[model samples]
Target chain A: MRDGEPLVRWAWIGDHVDELAHYTGVHLRLGLLPVLLGLLISIPLGILCHRWRWAYPPTLTAANILYSIPSLALFMIFVRYTGLTERTVMIPLTLYTLSVLIPNVVDGLAAVPDPVRQAATAMGFSTVRRVVQVELPIAVPVVVAGVRVAAVSSISLVAVGQLIGQGGLGYYITRGLQLDFPTPIITATVLIMLLALVTDALLVLAQRLLTPWARGKGAAA
Target chain B: MNGFLNQLSLVGDWLTSSQQWHGPDGIPHRLLEHLTYSGLSLLFAALIGLSLGLLVGHTGRGAFAVASVANLARAVPTFGLVVLVVTLAGLSTAPVLVALTALAVPPILINTFEGIRGVDPDARDAARGMGMTGWEVLLKAEVPMALPLILLGLRVAAIQVVATATVAAYPGLGGLGRFIVDGLARNDYELVIGGSAVVVLLALVVQAVFTALRRVVVSPGLRAPASGP
Candidate 1:
């Protein structure tokens, strides 16, 4: 009877949606916090380099070098110090995000027509105001694209965190494999794909929501 | 880091053990027995994928069906699917090869079909007007233009095989993944890092080799369009 419990998977998803939501929310927070941190750090870094030409290649190099560190190896490095808490997950994942996010953000900002910035400056817009009103708004779509990539990568990386015993859906996959329960393993695996799809869809919707100007441009075009 | 230096030395040390390399382990002899498993599977898949894609493109009506099948297969996580295959097929190199090849076929199939579909219509018309047979037109006109996209599919398959060939470790054929899994078990970070480094290096090397081959085989005009818009 007790053995049957393992096979008796329920529609607990309905009653337990909140708990699942919490799990996904934490995982997203874990994944996105670093992305958020990375964006905060690297976008400004990217902007500065974009504003000043010399910092581009070297800043870009730092991100590339960081990216080549494979996710599992990175998780190991984090484990050596932090012993597999959220910090361990965030640090390497954040570092990884800088590579993907910075280049896009910088590219988007650079894609801003030179005339627009010059015209903003000529209009006596303060440097900060020019960047705020002119640059970020124009670069929003590309930055959002970068955010999409980071979101996907980080959600996938959440599985690695489960390797160290974190309790996301990855825990279900890893734990089931260990115990020889394919049901849980398959369920968890499907859950992960679902989670990733949901994250991607949310990001897409968020991009549309945040960039009303894109819709306006689409309409006019 | 010192850790990095230590790994380089270990690789250097292992390279010296010829027996292990040729036979099993402790050597860097590039064992053919294990290498052929992945190679043959990829070869088999590419052959099937190309044939199916060609049939679909020439037929055209069944494309939506093929696309749905490829999408469904590709959606399965390589790790989970491999595990499922192994459980069903019994633990051995067979399941690993099947899983990798199945995983490989979709990309190649999709690319080849799209590539053939994208062959310029005017070019096809001109070839026909020039007194070419249907087969002659396809061979001389369509395949030549589609070669780069076909090669790109093969390249993706090659990289995927290189990475996924590691997953064969669980079934006991002992690719780079064996080192990673063992390293994880032993808490030897160096082994995991070293193993991954090798896999990454292998992938990069394969990519470079294919890229160079693409330059040699693909015609200049076709190459540019086949590669990008």
Candidate 2:
């Protein structure tokens, strides 16, 4: 909108750079915070479920159903109950991540090779120590992959949060599409892609470091 | 006048329809249309993505580069791509089709690339020994071995796209997302719930289709080279 601003280009990116920066941080924080919380709670929950067969189905089912909930619909539900804002976004997203990641954590922990668990049990290792040392290590790769998936899903879905008055990179996207201004919309689209790529790269780095023994290629494992 | 009354179901039509329990937006025909919109976008994405992916997966250096770039492409947000496509193609079907196909492409590309790459070198050598050319070996050997994994990738991509096509309503193409978006605008709870039911069903149907398709291509013995997803 300013004089000397280039039209038909992402030049608006510079003018709105601060708004974009402010919102991008908000977006990442909102996206990653729930994942961290999900990881913390689910790791123990997964182990407890693994240790107790009775706890398996319900814990797993709850999250699986949540995973199946469409983001747009779920976000609308949050909007109605919570009113529109990042808070609304955060709540549904946190719930959603738990559904996917918790189950993965549980399964990953359960999949710790029987021989390794047997050896630990035969060595008279304490249940807690055995879990913290052996099972947790083996499960980290799968759990991280789940976390990566959650992170990616949240960042993209959070764009919906823009409609609720949250000023994330999604701000430009929502406005741009509605206002017929390609500048903001395309800029926002490219920015989200860059954000996704960077986040994915970070996950890849984390995965490579966490699972040195995993021979499977790429960030997939 | 008599025919009009007959077509109106003697004024009792409302009682049997889902409108009372599920709301006005929950009518079966409307739900089917929503499914059709989402389903078609996914179908387009799969057909386009798998074709382009297979091409890149089996070809030379440029193909490899395209496949690698697709990894980053998958990371690109679907909502963002919608915005981009809307900017480039406007609010009609083109943007949505382009966006959904872009969303589907990366997984198909990566899976097919990896699947082909993962083909046994010894198998290629065996094919060549049998007087097969490079393309011959690729069709007869590489595709079959890699088909299962590639299909898995395509399956996952299909599932993701089914959910994502709902995002297209933001750019003006209504699918199940229409109910959610329009309902949100009007605070129509029934519409929201009814709309979500359609999305859930769409996801399930896509799941079922992929599961049945997987049964066809998954066996190790089914690794026929010319068989493409």
Candidate 3:
């Protein structure tokens, strides 16, 4: 707006480097941990559903209903029980991940071909070993795609936690709006987008590494 | 135990008060503001997104490009965009409309595109064989067939916009979210919870209305398979 003051001021970030780092750390945790927790819960639950046909339909329906709940309502409702602590934020964030992840986990397991299961069985693989060694590995790409969506969505939702005073980059957003400053708002938005892209790329890398068979054998010159 | 009871009573009192329903500060007014913001944003988003999506789907070109942009847009936080717009444009309804519109666009666009793309090729061929023009085939044949998924997209977009538009109150604007933002600042947990209850109720009602409408609008033959979880 001024001669030297751009919408996003690099100098302001330089001046508040320590606070920026802290906020960035908070943002990363708020974004990443919930999705990780969801994945942890989903893998076993998804496997059980895959093993037992009866569980899949009900579980899928429940997840969809849960997904429909507004994130703000979910975040705020927990305040009564959890107080203003980080758990209030983490619990809903973690639970929300289940709605998106469970469906994806089930879809991933479903993507596994029937012949692959029979092949593993014929090879004398036990149920647990076959699932771990064969089905789960083949399911990684589909599951990872879901993970990417969950991760990105969680990151966006985490910003909403600022209303409760727990948001990381969200602090800058609220603070900026309150002060009517353009710099922090612009900077945080850019950083959050970059964070999403980085997280997506990392997940893609994880998918590639986990499923080496899916990759082309070293390309030649 | 006592604190929870007090909160409940507080919320009860707030909801029961005739004063809360009377002025611009009233729940009714705030609800009106919230719906107006969400509704207008949805309309604008649907107009732009549906048209582009229809063109992309019917032409079968730029599908990859649209998908890439939609996926990228998914990562952009609504709060960040709202704040950025407010700072640039100053505090007004503009920020809320712009931010919620951004939120509503991708799903509608993606769904409309997919709905059109997913129309049975045989049906498209049959329409062509019947000597229909491209416009006639698209309007009569494809659009009708794709209506269910397109409606599904609109339902998703509308619910999301309604929920998120509450944040408009955070920037000193009036919406149901005003209760939460103001209450939190003043340590009025009851007001916060009361506001959230209304938001949750609104969300569920919107979902139910859409679900019911889907049953009415979608051909009964299409309903069975389109019942996506």
Quick one: best TM-score, which candidate? 3
iRMS, candidate 2, in Å: value is 7.9
Local accuracy of candidate 3 as per-residue lDDT tens digits, B119-182: 9999999999999999999998999889898987898788678767877677766788888888
Q: CA lDDT of each candidate?
A: 0.67, 0.69, 0.81
What are the C-alpha RMSDs, in order, of all predicted structures? 5.8, 7.7, 3.3
Q: How well does each candidate reproduce the native contacts, as fnat? A: 0.05, 0.44, 0.62
Candidate 2 C-alpha lDDT tens digits along A158-206: 7766656663788788787666676886676667767766887798788
| Displacement of the residue A104 alpha carbon in candidate 3, Å | 1.6
TM-score of the second chain for every model:
0.86, 0.75, 0.92
Residue B152 accuracy (lDDT) in model 1: 75
- What is the per-residue lDDT of model 3 for residues A1-221, given as tens digits with 9 covering 90 to 100? 23545677678988987898888899999889888888899899889887886887678656655666677776778888887776777788787777667767777788889999999999999999998999988888878888888888888878888888888898989888777777888878878888888998888888888888888864110
TM-score of each: 0.69, 0.74, 0.90
lDDT measured at residue A2 in model 3 versus the true structure, 0 to 100? 32
Sorted on TM-score, highest at the top, how do the candidates line up? Answer: 3, 2, 1
Two-chain DockQ for model 3: 0.52
The list of candidate 2 runs beyond 4 A from truth reads A1-11, A45-68, A85-87, A95-124, A204-221, B1-36, B52-67, B118-148, B212-217, B220-229
In angstroms, the error of model 3 at B83 is: 1.7
Q: Compute the DockQ of candidate 1.
A: 0.17
